[model samples]
Target: MREAQFYNKIEDLIFCNLCPHGCKLSEGQNGTCRVRKVIDGKLYSLNYGKISAINLDPIEKKPLYHYKPGSLILSVGSVGCNFSCGFCQNFTISQTGETFFTTFISPEELISIALKYKEKGNIGIAFTYNEPSIFYEYIYDTITLLKDELDIILVSNGYVNQSPLKDIIKHVKAINFDLKAYNEDFYEKICHGSLEPVLKSIEIAYNYTHVEITTLIIPGLNDSEEEIDKLSLWISKLSPNIPLHLTRYFPNYKFQIEATPIETLVKLQRIAKKHLNFVYLGNVLLPSNTVCPNCNKTLIKRNGFEVQSFMTSNQCPFCSFEIEYIKI
Candidate 1:
């Protein structure tokens, strides 16, 4: 158990300012995240160093198409999440605590493991699977230790507070933020969170490092054309080059809503492409290729997670159009 970073004491309760939740807990009480707790009138992170899952996955599996396209990354996830989404796919780990089976991997040991896979095209570490913002201290320590030796990526819900987000973004190279939905009601009722903080986080993150956004299109909830247009336009205002992923949603956890229609994903992708330069469909396989937004020339050909062919440089070989990609 490690002392948490973003919290302070009130009269008798400790207030956790990690995310927008601002959970106030008395002694021996856990926050809504199920990880952060109040012990002796101070906040503690119960999930620190307790890894629920780890794997070496293709960076594309993170759905990060624009950043480090073909490289593999050591993905690590800890328990607990700030949002209580009903359709959470990783709820087994994200909603559990230390009582659940987990391995204790120190920062030094994790770094050694990453270095061991350097020859296997492992670019660096990705704090993913669960909401990484809840495990801020562990991530901060590990990234500080690794520094520039390995690139750091975050797969997060992006519901973090400004101060902590700013502090951690410096060490991160790229991030895949789950935008979830554009409507405030959807955020409040479906995810038990708000939309404003997530939008704010995206705006703040892109300034420091590469940013990609993902929105899972659930059938009845956030799959409307208007919402997709608003979300795409908002992202375009930041930068049209930002890659947007429209993923299919399946029944999971508490939500038993039928899987999202492929037709909805295709329609939303077309609508998104109107404002965004790079748009891709996920989950159900369509064409997962990157094309030059200007000339509509296939720039990167991908077969599943494998990169079949791509331009040697950042510019399109045929049209010389600048491709928005981080060089691997």
Candidate 2:
């Protein structure tokens, strides 16, 4: 295990400052995340370098609609999460402890694996699968060592504390932040977190690196038109070109609610289009294509995670209208 960063020792207890939860623990006790433990007044991350799953996935599968679309990325994840979302898709790893699905890899080996895929057109490493925020020490070190060679992408729930987040954003090339909802009540009751911190993370991340936001639209929860409108407005204020992905929610883990309807996703996409120039629907079998904001022409065509780019730059290939995507 690796020593944690952004922590303070309160005599007999160690306070974990990695996230807003800031779990304080006595010796032999674990934090709210159930991964960090205090031993002799020192805190250590039990999940460090303890990978539970790893795979090669499409950059689009990160739900990153803009950055180097159509390319594959090396996705790596460890066990444990900081939040308690009821609808967590990867609950087997995120909710349960690290005892299950035993797998291990060192930071150097992970970097080696990522480097080997450069010829296959992989952009870089994705700290995903589970909450990489909690594994701050490992990710920080790995990305620091690999920064000169590869792009670093983080697919996170966006519940991290600001101080550590600020320290790591420079090495991160892009992020797909999961904005569960716009309402604080939803975050408090459903995700065991707050909306304000996630919003702050997004705001801070946008200025530092490529930022994209995703909201899993669950029916009867955060699927209101007002919520979507507010979310789009906030993102638009940052940059109208900021890509917002409105993903259809699927019932998983603790939440027994049905999957989001196709009609609802279509309707919200229309609402988001009013504020944001680029909005895409996810987890549904729609025509995954990019359209021009000026002439309404199809710019990029996508099937599943496969993307066919029509525009070379962030501008529309047809009418020369500007698109907000990054070109590799």
Candidate 3:
């Protein structure tokens, strides 16, 4: 087990400041994340190098529509998350503890696996599936070692504190930050967290890597037209060019609300488009295609996960408008 970072010893206990939770733990007890424990007066990361799942997946599966469009990326994730969102899609892994997990793979082994797939059009590694921030030890070490050859990516809730985030951003090439809502009350009530840190993380990431934002518009929770406008407006202030994906939230985990209505998804997309350049619907399909903001010409056409057609030389074939991204 690796020693966790951003912690302070408090007599026989320690306060872990990895994320906003600031979990205070007694000796032999764990933090809110359940992955950081205080043992012998120091905090340690229990899930380091203990990945629950690993696979080669499409970059689009990361829901990253703009960065390296159709390339494959080695997706990896360890258990444990800082938030207790009611709509967590991967709760079995994110909320489960060390007792239920058995996989033990080192950073070197993961890098080797990614390198093997590199020849087959894989861009690099994506820390995904669950919250990757809680497994900071393994991620930091692996990225440090593979920085020369790999482009590391983070799929996160954007709840991490600044110190650790600043330390790792140099290694990350891109990130997809989940922005659950634009209101603080929604975060506190449903997500068991605050909204400020997530916003700060997005701003920090925008300066460091290719940052894309996703807001799962849960029906009756955060899908109001006003909320969508607020969320998109905040992102637009950061950069209107940043792609904002309005994903359809399905009923999952503890949230038994009805599936997000397709009409709601389309309406949110329309509302978001008012502030952002590239807005798309995920989970359910809309006209899943990329169009030029300047000319209204189709640039790339996608049906579900399939890329059906590409026009121009990565530009709008009709208007010669340079495409913002390259099809990989």
Identify the leading candidate in terms of lDDT: 1
Steric clash pairs (candidate 1): none
Which one is best on TM-score?
1
Compute the lDDT of residue 63 as modeled in candidate 1.
79
Q: Taking the tens digit of each residue's C-alpha lDDT, what string does model 1 give over 54-116?
A: 999999999798887788999999898998898999999887766359898999899999999
User: Please, what is the TM-score per model?
Assistant: 0.98, 0.97, 0.95
lDDT of 2: 0.87
Clashing pairs in 3: none
What candidate 1 gets wrong by more than 4 Å, as runs, is none
Q: Could you tell me the C-alpha RMSD of candidate 1 in Å?
A: 1.0
Local lDDT at 275 for model 2:
97
Query: Compared with the true structure, what per-residue lDDT tens digits does model 2 show for residues 1-328?
Result: 8777888986687878888987878889888777888876788888888888888899999888778878899998888888988889888888855655656678799899999999998778999978889878889889777756988999998888888999999889899999999999999999898899999999999989999889999999999999999999999999988889999888788888989999999999999989998898998888878778789998878998778888788787789876655554
Give the Å error, residue 119, model 1.
0.8
